[model samples]
Target: MPTHTDQVPETPRRRPPLGPEHRWVILGVGVAAQASFSAMFSGIPVTAITMRADYGLSTGELGLVLGCTALGVAASDIVWGLLTDRFGDRRILLTGLISTGALLVLMSLAVVPTGDGRPPMPLLAAGLLLAGVLGGSVNGSSGRAVMTWFREGQRGLAMSIRQTAIPVGGAVGVALLPWLAASHGFRPVYAVLAAFCLVTAVATWKWLHEPDDAPQGGGGTAGEPVRERSPLRSREVWRLALASALLSVPQMAVLTFAAIFLHDAEHAGAVAGPLVVLVGQLGGGAARVWSGRYTDRHGNRRGYFRTVGALSGVVIACAAGLTLAGAPVLLTASALAAGGVLANAWHGVAYTEIATMAGARRAGAALGLEGTTLFTVGFVVPLAIPVLLEQSSWSVVWAVAALAPLLGVPLAPGRRP
Candidate 1:
């Protein structure tokens, strides 16, 4: 028998399992991973002018190229969700980040600069589409990881934090990409993005680990029976997906064209246009965090979601009217900030609700279904925005986009269907 000082120090008390600290670590990892993916896709619109001028792409062709990313994301979301549910979040996220980085690098290499210094449009579009397919892995896997790590009470806050990565990354990209494209060229922009992704992949491989207590192959609440049925069959799931899709139209509209609108319609300079987008992104990120905290404290995710949606509709409509009335640039920028914040605030709450409804085991599939619906609409909205701008005016486009969120107010979950 060992003496009092020789008993191996009682195994150092096993460190009591890390408690809340581990959850935050998980959150940080999720945010970084999601942001890496978002930067690549969200940065595209900020470079629209450069791409248009370089490649001689018309409005229609540019929209098509941007929409291709959404199409690829929609197509692959479900597949990635299935894989996440089957194998777990760590493996899925690692695979996605690594593969996506490699694909982006390949796209950079495939760029055949014409006399005008732009890659062939077809090749560029195809490259983006392929990158998007790999990037879809980020959403489902990161979401599932957060859900598994946090308790029910903390989920709204945690999910909101994860969701904030979208706008936060967009803010960074919108600020950086335009300047990079202006100074160095498009190829350097992509190279930097690829490097960011690869670095995130290595970090994830090193730091992200599956929770030991989490259920294997399924992610429901403790003792809850794992549901093998498709989450698509649930009415709540379908309604939530529809509402998310509808609300996303306005959000995507602003993201895809706000800079262009500022430059062309408002007669703002190149730097001024992206600056407005950057402001909107920052405001949207803060709104998401606040909304998440509020919903968590109040336990009213559905109600908060509906309220934000209705507010977004009003804001967008008002913004459109003001623009038509020749509002000052400052006023228009404020309107974009308001509209973007309200429009984006609901994503965290909406995603948390879907995961809770589906339970931990089926959270991946549920989230995937939501992604598919949202991105399918996202794919179409970009294509339509150009047509709307050409046939009508920016006023009409904003007014029409407003209707989507207003319709979503009644759709928010409450009483039985």
Candidate 2:
């Protein structure tokens, strides 16, 4: 037996049988995990109306539901990362899927606004917070598995495809859950998502493998795995954080309220609400894969990040403008453009860069930190935007979102020290 101190081969030491690649199988499991986790988040937009109708919740209260989830996502990332780093990815991933699935079912079946005719705000808030925390697991443990399995140049494409699971799950939620809730009520939505999550959790546990090549020594790979110390420990981390923060605000803002903004501010009709979200998600899913491939080929992410950041800002501004213009034809296109470019595109590269920057050994922590920052924005933006909109018009609300990408401009290639 090889000593724990011995180095593993860089490539798969014992290759799988030809004509049926195991890598694709692993990717499938990862995608399924992400899809299941996404179902947990996807319910927000799809079920918001139902929640409001049932509870007679105000905008601030509704925003709190979304914010609490983001708070859960932000707060739990480090814990998930540490767990993935300590336990094997397969175990953590399975655990996340199971716990999240159980919670999703609980959420679907939970009866809020109980007793004496008052809504159960605290109970509902608690559930949403719990769901968000569980949802964060999707990106951490499974993401670590994907990063560990894929080679450097291939990470972008692999991660992007994995990222696609989000939209695929979201699209499913958008198309099915809302309709189910509208017709059969929320129980069906919970039952369907829970069943899907459990099935995927079982499949992931049974089939997912840490790549044979995962950098290992006897004790297991833990902490920063990069050859050099993390650029994150230096000023670069702050720079990256700033860029990530700026872009995150707009990204989350739109996600939290795109449908609401369209329906209430622009009068786009109720049917268009979830459809717009689906379009953005689908566009983002495709862009994530494309951007990953692009980053893999380029070898450096600076230009790609800078370009996407700028373009996202531009797209957001255009969308906001078109939205305010009240022109039906242009509004949908611009909205989709923002969703495609800003919402999902930048993340594929950003996360890929985080994985690569940390190297295989430390990728988990890097991703953990990255997710923490991103979801923190997720927590803040939902609550913040509603407050912003409270005193002002939707245009002011969106303009604030549009400025997010600009904050990243200082982090572009030449600007960073």
Candidate 3:
């Protein structure tokens, strides 16, 4: 008879723990993936002038076209989130990036203007809508992947770093796309954006991955009952999602229209408009990073989120007042910067809270739901802004936006929830 050791099957060797370098690697890949999609979506506003000139579109028409992308995103965000939950982040992200890039290329080919200089608005809108559908994959997949890699204590910082990609990508798009559209035309801008998506797709395929030991459905501790298996059923999740969606109103308002406001209302120069947007984005990115760090150390995610929202309300209220009073350009710009920074700073923390509430297994779905709500807001807000501007002044618009964040304060999750 064989001894116990000789008769027993050999245990499979465990994979080595991720090294220090791996953390940064994951963070870099996540940031890159998020940034590519962010640039594509946020870049739309930068091309408004070019599109208006080439396609003979009015401000309302252009706003409608831009809003189409958000509608697409809202429609698909939850589906992509569910996909990430089922198929894993790597596959979903790669599929999204590659397919979205291909669609962008198709849009460049199929949606151009004719001899009459009138583009088929419906077709262009459809293309952007389709692109938004594909582009929705980035946020959930990238966020889930980062969550798997980072420990709970470090998640706020990691997610914040990932979130910073939005403003960073937007800043780049705002800085580069306008000039490209002015000099080279819309087709080149589309092609360049497609190239970025493709390149990032390749990079993500190479570098992005979930932890080997990650759990499915609910990231549970050993022997712990799965707490967030049905994230949609949880009332807390709904509350948080609602608050996030409401808070996004002001942020999107500034992002989509700040440059136009600066140029048209404030009479700031062309260069000054984009420059201010770029600076605001930089400030927003920094605030996100700082907020993430603060939340991680303080361990009060909800409080931090509420505090940021309240502060955003104050800043935007002040900005509305300044704009209405015809304050100096410097004062108006400062208010915009402060509002943008505070409004945007809460995103990472809010996402972290969602992920925490849902657990790892269900985080994709939770994030997807939140994204869906926020993108729905994004879709509606742009369309509404034009109508608001038509009916009222920029001051009226800003004043209304200021109220959005304040509305979110009461909805912010509590420590237990």
Ranked candidates (lDDT, high to low)? 1, 3, 2
* Total backbone clashes of candidate 3, pairs 3 or more residues apart or in separate chains: 1
Clashing residue pairs, backbone N/CA/C < 3 A, model 2: 113-119, 113-120, 225-361, 225-362
Please identify model 2 stretches exceeding 4 Å from their true place: 1-20, 112-119, 213-234, 329-333, 336-340, 412-417
Across 23-81, the per-residue lDDT of candidate 1 in tens digits comes to 78888889998888888777877888887777679989999988888888899998999
By summed lDDT, which 10 consecutive residues of candidate 1 come out lowest? 9-18
TM-score for candidate 3, please give it.
Answer: 0.92
- For residue 351, model 2's alpha carbon misses the true position, in angstroms, by 0.7
Worst 10 residues of 2 by lDDT: 217-226
Task: For model 3, state the Cα shift of residue 361 in Å.
Answer: 0.8
Q: Across residues 311-331, which tens digit of lDDT does each residue of candidate 2 receive? A: 777777776676577557446
Q: Evaluated with TM-score, which candidate comes out highest?
A: 1
Local error of candidate 1 at residue 397 (angstroms): 0.9
- The regions of model 3 sitting more than 4 angstroms off are 1-21, 114-116, 216-225
Q: Whose TM-score is higher: candidate 1's or candidate 2's?
A: 1
lDDT of each: 0.83, 0.72, 0.83
